[model samples]
Target: MAAKSSQTMTIPTDAELVQAQADLWRHSLSYLTPMALSCAIQLGIPTAIHRFGGAASLPDLVTTLSLPPSKAPFLSRLLRLLSTTGVLASNEAGIYSLVPLSYLLVDGVRIDGDASQTALVLAVTSWHYMEAAMGLADWFKKDIAQPVPSPFEEVHGAALFEESMAVLDPECDKLFNEALAAHDHMGIGTVLRECHALFSGLQSLTDCCGGDGTTARSIVKAYPHIKCNVLDLPKVVDKNPSDGLVNYVTGDMFHSIPPAQAVMLKLVLHFWSDEDCINILAQCKKAIPCREAGGKVIIIDIVVDSSSGQMFETQLLMDVAMMVYTRGRQRDENEWSSIFAKAGFSDYKIVKKLGARGVIEVYP
Candidate 1:
């Protein structure tokens, strides 16, 4: 046993307490940083800079981005903050250049006036989605067990899916659907390149809730021998053209999934609760064959882990999105295991090829 001392604890000085308060206040204002990025994206700053041979002076940017003379000073300040925060790079002469981070915001080579899919995702997150997060504390004060829907429902008066289906906001629906397609363009392409072996043996695959058939199209293009089908809601499938490359089926994944050799649920599981996810997985199991027949559910979503720095931060941020917009979550390995076990999956394998995300294969 150690002897106890009568020493008094040191008290913080007034200056120390004031400095701590300042630090807290600084963190509180950090939202302005992302808001600045959103503003830049809205103003087409990234594309402007890229068009200027990857570097542009403030005046050149103001002209290229078509900012009015009145907003030039404010735009300068925004760029300075973005550069200082390492979202972009600035040279000694105050010329701005695109960094790897800002490059994702650039319009794709096939630009049609919309923001890049990645940029659209960022913009949407900062808009109504973030407004929902702002109400989280107040939402938590309610009796959560009473089917609160989500924090999004607390603010918007409806769940996100319901609102999207209702077409209450046409602009929001367009943005959300386009963002999903863009995300699939970037993420699914990377997954296919990294894990081509996963799709090798499957003769037929169904991309459940696959919007616009981007994933199915990509898969069919890469492996023409394997037939791919996209199953989504009637309204969503109705908009997709009969491209002849892939078949589009109108249905709900909760009730049933069209029969296929394998079921591919890209970015779907994270948008539902445990019970809903289990139900959906059971449907997937029913749609596919036994493990010996090469049937499995392929999931592309974030797996929360603390081992990586940026990836862990990304997963935490996405978890907050799920909390705010839906009754879902970014699950850790154990949470995923529980869901898979509950869904009657005998085994699962996680392919950590996608940065900040993973490909999970669940076998029935």
Candidate 2:
């Protein structure tokens, strides 16, 4: 026999092994939870509960939902899963109630008309989104030194925006726009509410890559004295009606931006690489007055905070989401500083009160 081996493998204890396996299984099956939520949305569970005085027993939910008798037990199981997952509330007597989170799924409920379809679309698990997610493994295996497109591009053979505009799926496009509107509403709401001081002195502002004038309209609505302009591609601008409160101008942001005292790029930089962002910022710099004339770039995006546990996790999740969808990322303050420096911005300030995101004022 060979020389006696001194090394021995340390095996996990039975309980440890069992717990590990359970955790793995739980993670593996976690996809089912979102799928179940999607199914519930499809079955009008949120609407049913809302219509039933915000809480309904199984039989009452079945009646309100118009479900067949045979599916009651199965629906009950689904509800139990949703309740356990905190999507809804369930009492000891088997009644289901809508939570603030679940209430987002009810259409026509939002007065501001900024309610999101993302929750519903994500729950239904859009094929394009799912395909990109499934491609993550192959994406990781690619050479780290080599250039790469986003996982979404690797799957669909085009960037997310390019694919969305080129594709012929009307329903998908509508849902996507609604989802975008919802997200924009939330982010812009935060900026306009918490960062009003940033926009107060500026007379004219341009929203580069602004979609349907959502951000611009919100800004003008709050501060009517500030003239707002939105610059986007021709296709996006052609679809929306001209709101008297905001001007929608059609153009490519890479080549040019509308001249303004301040340029607001709300959630725009996160979709591009640093190089691309530098190019865009260069164009933005040219479009605005000098720093003494109240010229600056207002960026509303995630500034990753690693100090907080849950916020850090959410920021990382957004980073992965950006990886799957685009060549961008959720930047930390240092990364943002680096990008700003490269883009010829002399100084910047950050206001981090907007939940997981911040308003970064970049001066030229």
Candidate 3:
């Protein structure tokens, strides 16, 4: 029998121990960053600074926001944190200013008049999401055979998309749609610029699970010759009136999709499990023609790559967010390829990598 070797454990030096403590503390309190940002948004701090010609002193903000004088010190602390986190900029004079990050949070200032991330921030930092994130520890303690699939379901008693938010909370429903539209607007520019060739010769296209026809409208505007359709559930389609540009079809992608020369699934598959993704892609396959006929499914989603530095970290963060919110996860190249192959796709091509997400062309 081989003798087991005993490994000696070296105690961390004082400096190393102190550094480790700081790192641990940073990770432990990292949730405060988003919480502070959310609080700032709720208080209209970004807009207030924008109103002050892009700069506002502490007194200027308090006066403009009509905040009580007693809370000025507390507000100052919040601003300090926000400035430290790069959400806003602060000068030595203690005047707060909008940085590029905070500029997007200001109302009515859209990137190319398309969308602002204000809605996305609001939706993500809402109570329900925060509660689910808080419940993650307890969720992990559950047995493998437990009925609950996610922290969100554990808290809310149902999957997020199992029923329309319109039925559950009308305000949240509106905010959620706006959030998706905002996100799609931010990414659509990259897709159109980088993957223009994918849509050039297509006669018709379908945007599966498209929310509010945001991406569809952008596509139609870019390629006017191609007819565009937005496929979604009735709950989502009914609220969005036709603008005479893109046709909105009430349908489910898992069951069937309207036939098109090409199809696009923008940020949709990440919300489903692999089996569900395969089912959805198979339906997409049935909707489009063979690959030789210029038929393909364009997917704009996060393709996790560990070597991509900050982008990889963002992907991992979103992966955990998915774990808390749904049964889905962000996939790497191999995982994505496996799903595509299982869905009967013969081949696929990654057209471009747009920051944390990628534009993929999956062939039938």
Leading candidate by TM-score: 3
Where is model 3 more than 4 Å wrong at Cα? Answer: 1-9, 144-148, 164-174
Tens-place lDDT per residue, model 1, 18-38, is 998999988998878778888
- Deviation of model 1 at 290, angstroms: 1.9
lDDT of 3 at 5: 50
For residues 58-85, could you state the per-residue lDDT of candidate 3 as single tens digits?
A: 9999999999999999999999999999
Kindly report the root-mean-square deviation of model 2 from the true structure over all alpha carbons. 3.5
Q: What is the C-alpha lDDT of each candidate?
A: 0.82, 0.82, 0.88
Q: Model 1 reaches what TM-score against the true structure? A: 0.89
How many angstroms is residue 345 displaced in model 1 relative to the true structure, after the best TM-score fit? Answer: 0.6
Q: What is the lDDT of candidate 3?
A: 0.88
Model 2 scores a C-alpha lDDT of 0.82
Candidates' RMSD to native: 3.9, 3.5, 2.7
State the number of backbone clashes in model 2: 0
